[model samples]
Target: MEEKATSATFKKETVQRLMSLHFKDEKTKVSNDALILISELLKLFIMEAAARSAKQAKTEENELVSIDHFEKILPQLLLDF
Candidate 1:
């Protein structure tokens, strides 16, 4: 959907801007490989969360994913930490 695409684009831009600011503050050179790896990791996390949300909604009476659902699930996810 157009909204998803727009949100993705915004997230990408926000990450890039944040990374730039982070590097500027640290004043330490970040290799291209490191940046790429971080970006990919973020994307992976976003996708995984989205997939889980969809799966959970489907299994739970076709309900839509909501912030409240995410909040309820997040504590369990942190058990590994």
Candidate 2:
């Protein structure tokens, strides 16, 4: 089986809206490239967390990745951030 290519999952307009809300108090403008980069980075973060959580579940002989797996990795994830 061939693996499908995964594109960034976030909508640009939604991300732009979020950015606008984040900086609503200021006169700052978010650029298109910045929004794209932010979306890509968010995707990377989520992918990394899911992979790690899956690994944790597998290590414990569990078939399903649960919130416990995510909780186990949260501290390490925050450290990376």
Candidate 3:
């Protein structure tokens, strides 16, 4: 079976604004391709973080995911990226 690709979850204007803010010192424009790439990265980062946090919660036999679960996985998650 072929794996399905995930769509970009963020909007172009949001990514564009973020890029502009990041480069506030030097005015610059983000290309359409780069915008899509960054939006995908942002989505992946959040998804991975949530997945890892949920697993952490399951490990401790918790039904609902919480900030503590997220905190536990944060260090390793940041390192992974």
Candidate of highest TM-score:
3
RMSD to truth, every model: 5.7, 2.7, 2.4
Q: What TM-score does prediction 2 earn?
A: 0.81
Q: Which ten contiguous residues of candidate 2 have the minimum total lDDT?
A: 1-10
lDDT of 3 by residue, 1-81 (tens): 565587648999988887887785665777899998999899989988988999999999999999999999999999999
Better of 1 and 2 by TM-score: 2
Error of 1 at 20 (Å): 6.9
Write the residue-wise lDDT of candidate 1 on 1-81 in tens digits. 333432342245556667778564666556666666677777666665666667667777667897665665666555622
Deviation in angstroms for 1 in model 1? 22
Q: Estimate each model's TM-score.
A: 0.57, 0.81, 0.83
Clashing pairs in 1: none
What tens-digit string does per-residue lDDT give for candidate 2 at 1-81?
A: 565679649999988888888775778888889988999988889888998999999999999999999999889997996
* 1 versus 3: better lDDT goes to: 3
Between candidates 1 and 2, the one scoring higher on lDDT is 2
Locate the minimum summed-lDDT window of 10 residues in model 3: 1-10
